[model samples]
Target: MKVLEAYDLVKVYRRRKVVDMVDLKVTEGKIVGLLGPNGAGKTT
Candidate 1:
């Protein structure tokens, strides 16, 4: 079954498009991790 879904998710910062038209999905009963560089929008 579907657990989490993010459609057309967009985030802009400092007049710059950080996350543009992002689509993400996560299933149930699972551990998810968001891995990225130090400034790769991880803490944006």
Candidate 2:
């Protein structure tokens, strides 16, 4: 089973695509981490 799922996730700012065509899935009992540079839109 999937605890969390995201499909085609996208974020844009000022004509720039921060996140484009991204997919993510977190399965049951699984741990996940997202790491990125300071301005790499990790929080977006």
Candidate 3:
């Protein structure tokens, strides 16, 4: 089973591309961690 999914997710800031065409998917009872450096769109 799929819990969360994102397709073609794009986020830009100040005319600059931040998250470009990102796709994600998560299954049931799955624990996923997002890790990234600062300014890496970790909170986007």
Candidate 4:
């Protein structure tokens, strides 16, 4: 089970967390991609 799940995800700017405590899971015939460049936020 668990087709998709995300927990403890955080994003902050100015205070500068940016993305912290991030967790992600994908199961049951899964394909996932998260590539980063150009400010590195990746559309945060």
Candidate 5:
């Protein structure tokens, strides 16, 4: 079963494309993490 799903996710800031065409899928009992440098939009 899919615990979470996303499609065509995009994020832009100040006319700059931070994230584009991102897709994600998480299964049950799965753990995921996103890590990046400062201002990389890891939490954006």
Candidate 6:
């Protein structure tokens, strides 16, 4: 089962894009983590 799904995710700040064209999927009972340094767009 899919717990979360996303497609074509885009995030922009000012004229620059923080995140672009990201596809993500999380199924049931799955563990997911975003690892990145500060300002690496991990939250974007």
lDDT values of the candidates? 0.82, 0.86, 0.87, 0.82, 0.89, 0.84
Runs in model 1 with CA error above 4 Å?
none
Candidate 4 lDDT, 1-44, residue by residue in tens:
88889899898866778788889989999888888767867786
Model 6: runs farther than 4 Å from truth?
none
Candidate number of the best TM-score: 5
Candidate 2 per-residue lDDT, tens place, 4-35, comes to 99999999966778888989999999988988
lDDT of 6: 0.84
Estimate the TM-score of every prediction: 0.64, 0.74, 0.70, 0.38, 0.80, 0.74
lDDT of 5 by residue, 1-44 (tens): 99999999999977879899989999999999997778877776
Which regions in candidate 2 have their CA more than 4 angstroms from the true location? none
Q: What C-alpha RMSD separates each model from the true structure? A: 1.7, 1.4, 1.5, 5.2, 1.1, 1.6
Better of 3 and 5 by TM-score: 5
Candidate that scores best on lDDT: 5
Q: What is the clash tally of candidate 5? A: 0
Ranking by TM-score: 5, 6, 2, 3, 1, 4
Off by over 4 Å in 5: none
User: Taking the tens digit of each residue's C-alpha lDDT, what string does model 6 give over 1-44?
Assistant: 99899999898866768778989999999999988678767765
lDDT of 6 at 31: 95
After TM-score superposition, the amount by which residue 27's alpha carbon in candidate 1 deviates from its true location, in angstroms, is 1.0
